[model samples]
Target: MTGDPLAPRAAPLHALPPLPPECPLPMPVQALGRGRIANPPRPTTPPNMAWRRFGVIGGVVLLTLVATYQMWWLLRGDGIDVLEGLLLVLFVALFAWIVQAFVGAIAGFVLLLQRRPLRMGMHADGPLPALSTSTALLVPIYNEDPARLMAGVQAMHESLDATGQLARFDVFVLSDSRRPEIQAAEAEAFVALRGRLGANARVHYRLRQDNHERKAGNIADWVRRWGGAWPQFLILDADSVMSGETLVRLAAAMERHEDVALIQTLPVIVNGNTLFARMQQFAGRVYGPVIAYGVAWWHGAESNYWGHNAMVRTRAFAGCAGLPELRGVKPFAGTVLSHDFVEAALMRRGGWALHMIPGLGGSYEEGPPSLTDMLVRDRRWCQGNLQHGAVLPARGLHWVSRWHLMIGIGHYFTAPMWAMLMIVGVSIPLLHAGFSWGHFSLEGFTPTAWWREQDGDRFIAVFVATMFMLLSPKLMGWLATVSDPAMRRGCGGALRVFVGMLLETLLAALMAPVTMWVQSRGVAEVLAGKDSGWEAQRRDDGVLPLRELVRLYGGLTLAGVVAAVAAWMVSPALLAWMSPVVLGLLLSIPIVALGASPAAGRWLRTRGIFLTPEECAPPPVLVRATELRSPGTNGN
Candidate 1:
């Protein structure tokens, strides 16, 4: 068939339209022709990846072995009773977990020192190429406050519009809200947002009748329906916000690198008003980078995804990341709660690359306002992570992917293990005091003089070593910030940063026992077949009342007192060692109440304590985001 003379010539399949002035062509794009584009070669596994893996594993194993030996030496001939044996096993497991983290931190420090970009072959100095494909920006909402959600959406939309590349992207609010009132409010907000942006605005909203699998199913539905229209999609949480430049750069990077299936940007915590939130914000800004970079350095093409604040190729996601209903019932089976890691694993299992870029900036999210809020979230996460046991045996997963799943599972398990270790430690002395309780007693005990002679010093040494391993990552993070002049200044200089670190450490120590108990309870509950049902997170909740605090922690305080008295009866030295934990639990009510106080956070901010770079020198996008307010809506 002959074409009409007036017909416009069709654009070549590989050809991309001319980019705006802001979107500079990178080296990779410079090589592409109008009709033909060169696809970059797939990333190869680093030559030293095997050695790095071995080094991390060997380091953890060596430290564990040495620690175990010391522990054995300390406990030897103390009549190796059943309680003692259980204690040793728990201690070894906990020690190994901490050692693995220590090794990972050391590796991250070395990588940071090298000053290499986390994006393997991508250069840091070059300009990013313009995007050649359409992208959909998806914000999934549950029963969140419509005003807050719309505010974030409006800010992001405006930011993208300012980039002049807004035409290449569309915004969608995928609501899974169950409340009729919340749904009506969401609809009003969406309409207001669209009207404000004019008819040319690309923002759209959809509410699902049934949130089948929750967030995962919500996104899967989007993928099945509208996903085919776009080549890539960026996922955002209700509290998430990304700069226009960052979004465009992410798109450009995806365009340049065909082998990568997903890229997760490190989302810095911001907008914290409560003391608990401020502490988290400070830690995330100052120390989170080192840890993230370290993981990224070794993770390379197999890094895990964090659900939101990330970009994924729609085709790869649709084909590979369709999650299966887990084998059994509620808690351990059914729908996966923590779906990010598993989705990344499935993507990698299909031979697609998953990566993290810790160095990239302008991605932000909010933290839970109070400790109670955090625990509530943690309870759900704990159940989801425990469910990963079923996914661990899935065939065709990469070794690194399996390691990621195992690490996640191990995170929750550590809490219960630590709790068990403490119980055993306290009980050992009770057993020594000739207190025969049930099956555990010091009957017919054989004493090794050598072990008894050196036990105190050896025990002290093990204690010091464990403390070092636990604290080393924080130290490394502080060192990383101090090494950079700009970062140091942004964080209120060296002295202030050091003081802040000290305070943070003390507060963390005080909070550890409380978290331990809470997580342990969560694990127990999950194991008891009680599912953490999908509930809206309490993001903006205020400081809890003193009465409610007491009500929540009264049992814990009572247990702490009893335990303290029991330890004192055992010996003053044991009491001293257990004091930190006991005291923390005893003071749980006050600690939680004070920590959630916005006034206290403001006081700290005024004193230049726990101040983050983002707080000190706010980014323009962040400023804009904070300024955007949601319109009011009446309940249906």
Candidate 2:
């Protein structure tokens, strides 16, 4: 059958009518036709990616050898028995658990306790006064769709206009692009964005010619330019999206809490177009409430700001978070790159509170679209968080707070240790036959907790561990979400949302191993002094190649074998305990590969599984707006 010319054969897909004139997409920064990238030329050097691979392989090999050697050391012990060796493993595991539990519990309790002080949702009491002072909103951009960035800025500006709140808040575009083309394009895009919302005169854009400390320097430049005027600043990432109403509330909350130098909203993930993104978005929606609630209850004033979706008292950050240059440093030290935690600690040191509001609304952020993207991001973050080690022991500071920072540093370090520990830990039983107890001397000391070593029903224990580690707070939060009368009224009903959350949680579980493994490898590599280098993440989600996947996660294949053999030959209890880590390692490449693969994604979608949040719009917010259509809701 011939196609109708006007109806069907009218236009090619690429030449088809655009998504909408009102919602125009910016040109992707990647090169399309030829050598001409819409933005700038990428570094031809591949940014030490090979070094990263070599370092990771070397480090993993070294780690395995170290773990094997330690196990050997235990076996060769001249005077020790198997019982003592078992006791040692159990002791370390228990200690780690206790330390984790203690830290998590404190965070959860802090989140639960603060309701009134950490105000959220709409404030009908009238828009809070914009301080006579000025503050800038910094949105840092690398290689992203300029269209989406403009859209976000426009949305925020629209929200502000709706509430007449732009006067108090100034928005700034802080570009960290190296390519001259990107810089020029950003300038042009800035003009287009400004044209869309000229009333947002407070909105400003500046591109840094030299991105010294990456994002940290981007903000520092602003502080230097307009520091004398604005007393506070709000930092947002390229993906961070906040409602105008919420922004005002943040400014107001900052005003109300004299001690609060920074206020962070646990960003609600939004716009998950790809399955990976959607899964993350759904998970955050479903399981995030309780975990965030519990965390907020415990953290109280000690809540840390996660860089973006947060507001900061500028003067305090400048004075305290002034990143000191590292001494004798090439890989680990130079400039303070991850300044969020340090900045929070610095604010606290200056006697200012940094708090997280669990109930903040319309505050959104996006996640990486692929596993490779995530691991690449993790390399940078691991280094930054690990860099906290360089500052934790500074003079005349609260050791307890420093403990939190150090613990965070430990969090990244533990990935490799945990992976190795589980493998060696499970293999100990089989290795018992090889023991002579004479080659190495034993420094036998009783552990703080000893029951973990004794063989027990570990399958059930691991199931509990999985849920607790991944989904406890999510479930708890869902169960307890509608307890507040105001929130109950605000969200319309809890049941549907709760159901949405349950589905979100299950999907999150499947995705967790993928995230953990990637992060684990990233942390391990960064710890071994591997740099991720300067490459802009592709903003648009795209397909992943199998060859690339194998290259990225091939090493973890050994984990599956180790786990299977250990399960069959060694203790069932040990296997059960180590299964997730081991099996996770085993499936590492597959997970990374599948996560990155468009073909795999298509199959998943074809089977109707793990739908992402961006693919589906969020459930409409239950807002109680009087006068069916307020002037604020009217169009331009």
Please report the candidate that would top lDDT against the real structure: 1
RMSD of each: 10.5, 13.6
Candidate 1, residues 1-636: lDDT per residue as tens digits? 697989534333123222112211111101001112122335734557667778888899999999999998777764578888998999899999889878888877777767775464444334545667889899999999877787777778778888788889988899999987788778776776666777657787788898998999888878877776788899999999998878888887777767778989999999899989999888887778878887776787788999999989887788777787787766787887899998898778767788888887889999999889999899999999999998887777778888999988999989889888877776666556566545433333322222245476887788899999999999998998888887888888888888889999898889998999999999889989998988998776558777888888988899899977865654555667678899998899888988899999999999988888888899877887677742333211
Model 2's TM-score against the true structure:
0.71
User: What is candidate 2's lDDT per residue for 106-149, written digit by digit as tens?
Assistant: 34544444544334332524545564555567898886655557
Clashes of each: 0, 26
Q: Output candidate 2 Cα RMSD.
A: 13.6
Please tell me which predicted candidate would have the highest TM-score against the true structure: 1
